[model samples]
Target chain A: MTAAVAEPGPTDAPLLRVRGLDKHFGPVQALYHVDLDLPSGKVTALCGDNGAGKSVLTKCIAGIYQPDHAEFLWEGHPAHIRSARDASRLGIETVYQDLALADNLDIVQNMFLGRERTSRGLLDEDSMERAAGETLASLRVTTVKSIRQPVASLSGGQRQSVAVAKAVMWNSKLVIMDEPTAALGVVQTKMVLDLIRRLRDRGLAVMVISHNLNDVFEVADRIAVMYLGRLVVQGDAATFDRQSVVEYMTTGAAGRPGGPRAKES
Target chain B: MAGALPERAPDLTAAPEAIAAELPPEVVAQSLGEYVRAYTARIRAGESGVLPVIVAMVAIMVVFEAISPNHVFLSPVNLVNLFQQSAVIMVLAMAEGFALVIGEIDLSVGFVGALGAAITVQLVQPLTTNWPWWAAILAGLFACAVFGAIQGTLVTRLRLPSFIVTLAGFLIANGLFLKVLLLGPFSGYPNLAGQSINLQVVYYLMWGSIDPVISWIGAAVVVIGLGLFMWLGDARRRSSGLVAPPVSLTLVKIGLIAVIAIVVVGICNTNRANLGTLEGVPWVIPIVLAVLGAWTVLLQRTTYGRYVYAIGGNPEATRRAGVNLAVVRTVAFTLCSFTAGVGMLLYASLLGGMSNNVQGGQYVLYAVAAAVIGGTSLFGGRGKPLHGILGGLVIGGIYNGMYLQGLSVEWEYIVTGLVLLAAVIIDSVSRRGSSSGSVTRV
Candidate 1:
């Protein structure tokens, strides 16, 4: 095991920097030498159509699958994460679109599912409830009427909030959310977008995978477009319009030349 | 411009608080009804939680008592008898609960229990006797433990379902039981008569009395200790910024325990006849209580307990959690079989000897029924050993009461089947309600 080296100085280096990452499933390549940097305190949107390899790249970073070849740079030094547990231990929490919340368990139980506190050799229900309440409150998730209510009773938007809060509760520096606003109503979508902004404002890096351009425009600070398992363009959110991103996402190259393409994109 | 905006609200309205206070009674009632609807909806969504099953159990008991004459069905002696008879069933149910908690089943409990008795008798008799009674008992238990471990390893390492593995065990164990029984019927075994062990030991444990004052003190101490542990634990957890059950819920649980203890003691103090004194706690009661405590702790308090629940809920999730699924699952099966072994020893003592042509299959079925009736989910990821005790007691009560009423054995079987079916149906309905509305959180 190599020693994990922290980057020098605060606000000096990107939280996560993936370089020359390649992944293959049998004969077909899923991700082709993808390179991207997720800086601290910003929401970076990874957008593409179906089969753009967004899910594949997200899973690799989340440690669900090991990349065939890649270097995961944490801070300024390369890091190796082999499992989801390892990623979690390194303060990287991923909230997949499914959320992975147990339906039978209530809000608090779901929030602390795997990492429950024990006192005197039993589940410390009081402590868990209080902590859950505090975490939800801190995240401004007030739509939930009761923490004791089962997660099944929660609406789609509330479930998303709970999933985010669960990740945030662990002091996660990098939170990856896969299509957080998918399959939600207009009101619910707005609530989730607000949550994304709140996560970034807390000085935490966020990587959001979404097909909804409206949501991307509302919350993302930076955009990375993937085409054919490779990031074709990367730039400030304010610099690119919807038409140019759509063009780049559908084609292998961006519309403009000598721009950020196939280099740092 | 003002018309287009529908005019801003006039400032002449009463304070906002006054407006809320003036809401209509019908509207408030409707809102209250909605709240209640939502609460019930949530409860219905979680399929395996405790409340719905508990309510059904109470309702069943009430209905039975109401339809019976003189409420004789609810008499103190009958209740005590119910507890006594349920002892074996409770032990067996707990054994099954352990297996079910890890999403498995133990089908060999009946034969395993018989095996324990057969071994105990053989060791204690003159034919092959070489050890004291205590040593023999320990040896019998050890043998069962080893047997359990073998079955567990087979299922875990070979990736076989426990149902199939234990079924095969059931056949092998029955053969062993028969072979051991035919080995010349060991003689001079303290109290052996033909094919039976002494009944005196069973009577002593089942109906023997302890000192009244001592029993009261013991019961009181237990209740107080439990209450203190719960209260203090809750407080400590709350202080540490963790989630805990409501304080009200804890108090309710403690109160229920106290009531149960006091009532049990009161029943034991009651005498059925003036000619013979029948007052005091039974030895088996304490033994069963001890077993319950130990097993409950094993399933709820240890890392092993977490692993079992995890495996039951989601094997994939547990695997991702870095738990060795095969090892934990096999250990659970082993424990289940070992407990069954203990139950068999006690059962033989109750009967005075191992009887020929024992229906091991029937007994195993009863054990499974007791567990399922007690609220343990067949699909796994939910259940506690405590359910075993409650379910066992209910079954035992029905058996004792029916026997007292001069019902035939066949009738008893029918009644047990019906009751088991009802309990299962209720469980299924409650589970459907709960799971549909909410996602099951670990």
Candidate 2:
């Protein structure tokens, strides 16, 4: 709960490192020994085909679903995240594919949905509006006409930006975005991708989930691919070519694991 | 998803400063006047403000005045009676509207109203326990809330359809209404209630009028309060550097309210009754207006109210925002029932008593109709408490006009049915126009 203007400090250490994460729903195993590492000041892309344990792993990290057997490491120390509130307390924020925005609410209201600033037992509109405006300005999202308009009235890209702003406004250490640019038009998609790169440059750990390989290679500094219910390949973006990443996603085969993608001049 | 845009790499060259500086042609607002123009354009685009309902109300009045036998519909006495009669239904409509905003319905509200009235009367009467007026009112509302909680729990926990859970509530409450009279309080009668609630406080609710001096003072306070709230909101928005509506627009709104208040007070100040000129605003008018103002503030300024609207729009999104869906939803039902209790007490004031044979089911339908007519959608996420007020007035005007015209209940039903259909049609068509505009670019 610092003022939303608090600057994020750069930390080269791994901000979050989850190892041997496993989750099961009745008879099906959603995540089987999934592992991920998100270092501060870096953008890590999680790439996988459908039902490839990417969402399962992100949800586990977000504490939406408790992992059956998982060890969460925060700054190289063991941590516990039992619920969504616990995840928030640990500064883990997730923007799901649905954008997780109430379409009926305005931009300011959506950005500070549950965490409204209250003074004198009423929502402090002035503070909330200023804070939301500042957050959007920092992200350079100026296309929206007014902060008072409903999310339902916003364009696809603006909606996604609002969702991302909501996630980052609350002193989050790691941001997990599930398909931040999906369902957006050409120009809007570019805006969101740029916003993601801005997040990494600001020294915040960003984990983006995407099926599009081009989007991954463009903004992602590191790439992690999952197959079936397990992490098969995890590395920096330069270590793997587009075809190899696809191969890893579908067939869980790659030259190596747990490093950067192959760099090309 | 991310890099699907072809211009991604080249676009990254633009600094955040440059990006922030770029404003699309439509969004470059240079003046408050432009903002006002844009506001009207948006309403024309089908995101209708309250103007449509207001227009419809005016039309109803015009039509009724022309067709009335003696042109008595415009009589000040009829106008006062219409608003007073509308008071109870308006409350019920507001109650039903809360549930509707969340895409739920409380069919039990009508009978809940009956039960509340029955409980209120039983409390003050000699046959049962005698409580003070305010306590009796609170106790009745408490019962209604508890009953609502039961139905809400069943729906939320068991994953039952709200329609079914509240339908069960409707039946159970009706039976309880009769049972309360028979075994609990009124053992003298095994059938319908021949009882009347003659408590002076309850009796004078609608019948009472404020002194002329107090009425003027009350009207001044109300006008000033409204002006202050609207001005404060606008000033805050302007100071924050967000787009605020023009000062001219705010002044226009304040002026409109001032005019309406003066007219209403002037009309009510006339001596309609022959008994030494009974005048000034009716007590029920202020009571209803106060509740409406409070409810409006709750929905527009409070966190709980915002969450209610958000949950109604998309439950999944609200839940993902770390809101407790079950609790908010359950509270919504409780609030609905609580308001229903308030409406029933108003009904008792109008009727001078509670009767077991009251038309509870039909009244619930009327409440829903009023909300819908006022612009609340059945699908939820788009509504306000003001809908109940406007819609209630519409209903009251129609009923009062027809009765004055000597129309039968059958004709009343036919006309009212058509109006409800028209309202629903407006809701659906407008919704489609606004939503489909974005999704279907082709």
Candidate 3:
């Protein structure tokens, strides 16, 4: 593609727009006509009870599952993400809940796990170490003792930081984190929430999946709550309070019989 | 789930310079004293690395030297013979190291290796194929690699357990080895003692020695090269503000290498012959070292090696990283078998021929035992080729010392079995102390 073709589309458009996404497994429907918008430089929290289709939608966007019907607009252009590689090629990176880090490898090694840089058939350790350090520093993650420390030695927050740093280091335009702080302690959860805000401040589109509403309110600029395989409400963080969001999460609707369903962006 | 806000959110709006200034040092210190303290802390944390293995090795050497009949275990002749005898198992351990690092085991390496040795010996027989020594060796290694690929494919593609696949491979290879030895104009064995210069070179692989002068020169070159490589690389990383070992640590490591090389060469250069001047470094010693050096680089400096470790630690993570798990696993098996071929070639040289009577099963046990005793975690993702070398030496020392004491083969098995159990216990205990205890598999 030429330079002109490289520029995706208009700058102000949402970085990733998902419309009418549907997914099913045999006779069961997991996600139903899910509509979502992930704007750049903002954090959009995805909230749902278990099996409420939050993960199913994230996996669809991550190219881990083939949606039965979906329309994707990546960076303001119609794009197809058929594989995880395809999503990565489009500058979309996912930090799964498991963290997907090799425990035996050091921080730098885990950061550049698959896409390791090599020179003359040898791993360029110096360059990787420098780059990983710079990325961590940019994220203001100074809690870890050393980048060379093996991942198993890291605290839960430090591991999450490494995972996020890995995602952001790939020149990613959009980052989707699945429950970034599920198992973290108080201080560790604070560290990861701060990291999520930093990603948003860096002007990257961030989609966070979390069951913890406190973490959601701490970093999320916009929140989308799902129930029974449907997006009950999607709006700015200011539009909904904790009780409203919780009600929407469990009952598929907030206040009244026909309250605000899909508020204007 | 709701929770209270943090007591104080760290200042995210601070300048980059401010954050950098508050950052902790990558290493605890740059001086020798601080370096030792950090090392002790790490060891106490259960990341003792090769220290335990080295200590175990020294303990083995000391005990054997003190108790062997006439104290022959420490004699120069016996030491050199021990080195030669240990060569094959050391290489086999290295072969197993490849598969072990990838969280798999190649139970077939012993027989796979014997099959390769059989092929090499058969081809080099003047009355038969009459191939050159080098070509025959390559062919034999290739045969082993092919077998590895076949077994690897079954394990990776068919999703069969590696233990079962390689165990079946072990039986098939044992049968094939016998059949290959009986091919053409041979009975049940192929001897390497013939009128061919190629055959002589192959024989010299185990029985011959380098000239004293040449051995000294080679030792100097190796020591200097290795020392310079380590010192310069670490120095550059330190200068560039990267994570590197302390200057004192690098120098100490280099010094250790130099001391080891000098001692080994000095002992090997002395006259050990009761009748004539039959002293120099054995050819097999360098052969084993060369394999160790090459495999060390492959595992440490290559992307494939990184993937192997990653896969071993967490296969799902590796797959999520877009690494082809099947390909990496298959290649690991291939390299395992190929290295085993090298070990078997050395085995043939030591025995002076290839035959069906080789104890392939016992050798496989020795291979696993060596890797484990050398501090390689059987749980995977924590091993090195050097572990195989140290472990191999321990196995060889025990075997030689038992022979010196006139112990039966049964004792060798019993002692090795006990040693293997001790190693696995140490591994499991240390892992529990350091990380999450998930030792459900051997």
Candidate 4:
């Protein structure tokens, strides 16, 4: 990890808050009263093993899957996200694991997509292309030679960047990415980590769900550990190391009464 | 957040630093030569464009010429015949192209075209209250569009398979064609036996021509207009820091188009007229050309076209993008049927009448075959209108060539079937290479 971790500044308010967020599938509970906070201009890493409810929490915020019960507060104002459209309307965007980009569309088309810039009766291609070029440049994503090349032709890392750019293209206040670097190589992963940091530096709240602890440690400022459908612990990233996260992920025993790190704390 | 600022904030307006300043930007075709090389590599890698069909067309010409007892393949009269025959199929193929590009099939296009012709005839003939020429044609076209919308709605709203919906549409339109043909003022003609009818205007679309001087002038304007647009558009793209094909390439394209246009017009200008010198290309040529040009612009330049390609490539993704897939998909079918109506006009003109025995099934098959043969994928997400021209030419060429050689109808069917199979095989194989194989990005 190159950058030091920091807690949310005292003056900063949480951009989004999830309290007692519970989701169940049939008889199984995917999330159990998970509480978390994402403040403006910081990165929160959501860590968990496969069934620890990371995806559920993300979907809840994204409005892809409604939580069975939860109080979702947006900028300290309670807001109900009933659909994906609602979440985006409230300036929340998610980059799904699959990216969900149209392979046949070029960068400009993919970026503007549902929100194309139309001048009069026709597509304002010049304006849209220029905007796309500027957006990529602002994000320092210059891997692609042309904004007109189809997303199908991009590398995994470049595709992830495009997805991230798409998430941030609108006036999104909070961006959640699910396993963005899972399909990338070493260099690509590094590129994405830099992009995440770039997003944070732009004063946007970012939440990343990642299995890659190295990447989480590299970019995440706040660490929230999930275990068995519950938020076991959360703190400044400095409070945990790779070993500690692994222990919490497996045993859910970070700082509970009489637990492993409780005595030391 | 202050501490997290990049050590060196990127100059957002400065020249973009590519991922690797050394290697080629992973996705651009930087120059004309590079574009060609990449294109060839893509073709070899099974991203089949119109290249294969083009080669096949040339081969068909050569083989037919070599095998024929006479110079029947390139005879100017036969060339004109080929163009006329191809017009209907080309229009139909263009119709199928819209649906196919969006990962759907309109099985009803052929019959829909037949019904259009039937309606046109019914409206124009004195057996009915004689409607004017343009009114009859417009009414026919409108009816066809509405019919298509019905099927499109059924498919999109009900989430029914387009193939099945349009298959039902095919049968319905087929029966409707007969009912339109056998009954009422359609073709009973006040007392004569039920017979086919063709309006002079309908017939003249294939048989008529502009004056030679006017044809030559129109040809010049069109060719020059296309060249200027390409040059200006490419230059505009370059100035905006976007990668455009090299000027040389644009010039070469213009040159090639000019050359092809010259040859075709020259052939038509020859004294192929059996009666007093019927010179100049058929009026239909220009109409077809205009249709192709307009469609190219629509597909390449419009938001609707973008949505079609996007839906074909990834329906879920397009939906996620907040696009109403139903509306886009439905409008696609309507547009397809509208084009099919245009093809029906051409067919009626060519056959000199709208006949009850209009082989609607066969027409739809040929339409799909032409689209696929021209390199539009049946698996979807990739295609162009230009492909209809190439594929229709090859299709019309085969039928004309075989007839010139005195081949029987059965042989035409056999060969058409074989050619269609070859095209589908190529599509499937190429798709696998591009989508599921080792060189995914290629």
Candidate 5:
């Protein structure tokens, strides 16, 4: 596959580094000593089967769940994300599968939901509309008929685009998407894959938790496969083919330790 | 990152014209014809807006005028009196709209409002405290707001359903209304026609009127101010290259407003009094307009209003956005009660007193009926203060026309119930249409 692999920068440190992450819910362990690195200008696809702890890891980074024992580094500095607000302050935004959008509100309203801008004690509709337009344009989202249209009137692809634009407009350095393309049709999936690439090109580190192998290989710069609540294999997309990813995702390993299917340094 | 997608560089820098072309024709509409076409398209797609209500109102008027004795239903005297009679229901509906917009209901507004008016009348009674009318009104509204806040707290803090909370509120306020009226110095209630200038002012709120010249000038000022506000705002947005309705459409809206104001002022100024004593617009018209204007701004142009709609539409989504849902919802109830106090004040003025005989239960039902019939969704998140006003007019029109025909009050209830059911059916059908293949915005 002709993956647009993002070249590593000269700096060795990554944008966000998670080390020895462990999470538990009551008696069941959801994640076990997982280490992950997300570099800027790259799309890292986290692939796994159901109950593989992909969602748990994404939630931990998003501050929705607190890992029992974990270390988080933001831009190579120690960072604590105890809540959603804390993660936002550190420039991390998450786009959940449900999108968390008010269907009755227009695009401009939804994009600025909690943090609406007001002037002279009223909503500055002109400024808000202009800003929303610019954000959508920057993302090359041209399918929407108008920025004032309510979100309920939008197609699945357009809604997904708006969700991404909402996340990217906040100057977030890292955006974690949970199954963005899971509900989209074929054409809509392509639209989202293009948008994902645009985010990477804009130098944002994106971690996508997806179960679709074709979507992951199409947009992801790096591949991380999870199995039985553990990170079984992670490396550049060039090092692992579709078969290797599937093998590691189900069996926890693909080949011998020294073989190319093993985790690459 | 720059070299990663060299082929996409030009696409990002595409010309503005190219981007503009990608938008729908309606977004870039440049002519009156195009604007009208777009609006018609929306109407066809089930965004009927207030059009259906207006049609219903017109139909009601025509049918009543054709059948009422001497066609008195459309006469200047009856029309002027109709507005005064409707003022109470209009304000109450506007009050209930606050809760309805936030996906909640306040069943206590009727008695809460009556209780508030009773407090005001009691305070201003010459045989009692003899307080200024303004102070009494303020004190009464404060009490109503406090009650609202309490009920709101029970709903928001304790996570109780607002229906049950406000239902309990209704019973408590009914009891309180009786108690408050007894507190007055009068045998059973308080009267407004007392020996005090402040009391006259309160009485004049519904029973009196401005001079003809002042009425004309006031109408002119209102029309011009509303027109200028709409035009200037839209013009500025257009100049800034933002999305705005076409200029012609804005002017058409202004023209419609001017026409409505003219008809109202013309009818009111025609000397409705058979004895040639009372004339011009009743003081209640301006009061009702003021209340309508304030609420329209509060619900349409403010962040707080947006959050109300958001919370009503999707509480989980709103909570995720970090909005304080409990505070917003509680405040909505407070405003709902505060506005209800104003409505009850008008009610007291209309009757010249507050007494235990007030039909608080019927008033509350009329409030809900007016709001719902005016096009507000009982399900919430999709209503306006204007709907409440129009709905109130329909209710008032039916009562006046039926009274002229010498029909009993039972017919009024039956007809209103039928109209309300029709409105709910229309609202649901339109909602379903808009949610599906319709092009109209939700």
Candidate 6:
């Protein structure tokens, strides 16, 4: 395993470097020349509208679909992830919007699902339960009463937390969360936002894909805006103002030189 | 002061250990109470415990014995008869349970059993230039497995609902049965060869004393092996920091197995006849037990079993989990059909021949009912082959007891239908209650 080092410059070395990412379904290009860098221990937000290629980029990164043309770099080395399992093996975990949880299974069972620890054949329920409890608590998810409780019983926010905890349980280096708080109530949303911060604090690189500017502003260190298959802007979240982001999102040419842009919405 | 974003605080302190020592006592207590409530709710909703079902069956038997003035039903001979008669159904139920656990149903068990029997008889007949009985039996089982695999493939790969797939299988099997029978002089109906191959197999199996020592030993071995496996498995799990059933719970399970085994041996040892030379356990019992054991291990200990459960519980989740959903689904269907085939072979072995009116439909219904009653959820993701044994025994008891009372066949169907409906209703209600209760707890 490569040492997890924080990159000092934009071009120093990216943990995951994407160059000229392009995807086409028939004649419509879903992504075009999309270049981005996901550095270690930093939270990068991929922000876009419904059809602005946010999902396309996520799917490409997570190995759900192969990009028509692109290069994926890990530790400045070319990496080819053929499947989700391959991505997982490379310490890349994607938590989709659905959370992909088994509702009937309890927290411990869900947490250890597919990759359960077993002893002499039978499920090692106690160890998994203990580990799950530890993971949830370490992540400051104190809202859950029991690790034995079913995921279906949890609030949307708690479910999201569990999803993240599951990803982080296997020592994931990069956790990509797609709209972590989209369906959550205000309190639940706050809980999930706090979880995103906690993940970053744990020295894990976090990628949050969302259209909610408030959430991005609260938890993200950098924001990458995509519009109609091309990345329009990539900058530190602290440097960009809300008005300028909206301007870039609507019209690709924010304060930059001539660029094909969308009409302001 | 601009706040300076809290100065990007760096933790000079080492990271805390990941696992917590313990949760608050109140929370633990609350969670325990919730578990108890959920279990109770499930029981009330129609997830009938095996113990209760067994108790009810025994109680029904006692009641019938009391009502029959001649005490005919309680006669040791009749008791033994009950075992023999229920053996085929019990085996069929166990077979169906295999499929049910993976969230599929086998509707062709009855016809498949008939087909297997017909093949077995044909292969072993002297005029057909009889093959060794063991070899014939193997061929019969293999044929059934192949048949099942075909059905399984169609259902899994084609993405067809199992109900439709098996229903078509039921028809095809029945047609094959008639076609095979018509091809020979045994034309309209078939009988065992001049000498009974079934009786030969049964004699060899029950070859010892009035209380076959081998049978007793076999029963003891099964009980002890199962008990030790479960207990030790649980202990190892707990030691490794896994959630395991409490030690007391494990002991209770062992005790249940012991009791059931002892009772079965005791019943078999009882002298049921004043006339006729027949006493010890039937040859079919051990065979059924072995089949049950093998099926149980297959569904509980293998990656294939886990994939089956995963697919049944949530196919999309299983797919995302990187399991090939099609392969698992197809295999589950095939296993289900294969079990149906095994059930047919057992049926033929028990009866010694195939009949034109083999009650394929009726037996299929009972097999499904047995699975559901045994607590193998119709909606899937929660079941075991053992449930089929419990449920099958219950249905078998009813059939035997009712027939002994000289009850009409129609009445038997009515009773079975009522029981099946009751079981299904209970399943749905319990599932709903548990899900809702879980939501409340959350």
Question: What docking grade applies to model 2?
Answer: acceptable
Model 5, span B1-442: residue lDDT tens: 1101112222222333333333333464668887656556666666666878899899989999999988888999999989999999999999999999888999999999988988888888777798898998999999999999999999999999999999999999999889888774577767888569778888999998899899999999999999999999889877777777788788888999999999999999897766847788889999999999998998889989999999877788889888999999999999999999999999999999887888888988889889988988887787889988999999999888888899999999999889888888888877776666312333
Off by over 4 Å in 5: A1-10, A255-265, B1-29, B437-442
- Writing each residue's lDDT as its tens digit, candidate 2 over A1-265 gives 5453245433444889888888999999888887778888889999889988888888889888888999988776678999999899878899888887876677888998888899988888778877887888778777665666677667778888898889999988889999987787688789899999888888889999998777898899988888899887677777778878977887787655643442211
Please report the candidate that would top lDDT against the real structure: 3
Off by over 4 Å in 2: A1-12, A255-265, B1-36, B126-128, B182-198, B437-442
For candidate 2, lDDT tens digit of each residue in B199-300? 677667767799977898999999999899889977776665655666777777899999999999988988889677889999988888877888888887
For each candidate in the order shown, give its overall lDDT on alpha carbons.
0.74, 0.79, 0.86, 0.81, 0.85, 0.71
> Which stretches in model 4 have alpha-carbon errors above 4 Å?
A1-11, A22-30, A255-265, B1-27, B185-198, B436-442
Question: What shift in Å separates residue A110 of candidate 2 from its native position after superposition?
Answer: 0.5
TM-score of candidate 4 versus the correct structure, residues matched by position: 0.89
Better of 2 and 4 by DockQ: 2
Give lDDT tens digits, candidate 1, residues B130-207.
345566677777777778889999998988877888899999999888777766644322333332232333335455
The most accurate candidate by TM-score is 3
Model 4 chain A: ten consecutive residues of lowest lDDT: A1-10
lDDT rank order:
3, 5, 4, 2, 1, 6
True contacts kept of 3: 0.47
Which CAPRI category fits model 3?
acceptable
TM-score of 5: 0.93
- Candidates in order, TM-scores: namely 0.83, 0.90, 0.94, 0.89, 0.93, 0.85
How far off is residue A9 in model 5, in Å? 13
As for DockQ, the candidate ahead, 1 or 2, is: 2
lDDT of 5: 0.85
RMSD of model 5, in Å?
5.5
**Of candidates 3 and 2, the better by lDDT:** 3
Q: Comparing only chain A of model 2 with the true chain A, what is the TM-score?
A: 0.91
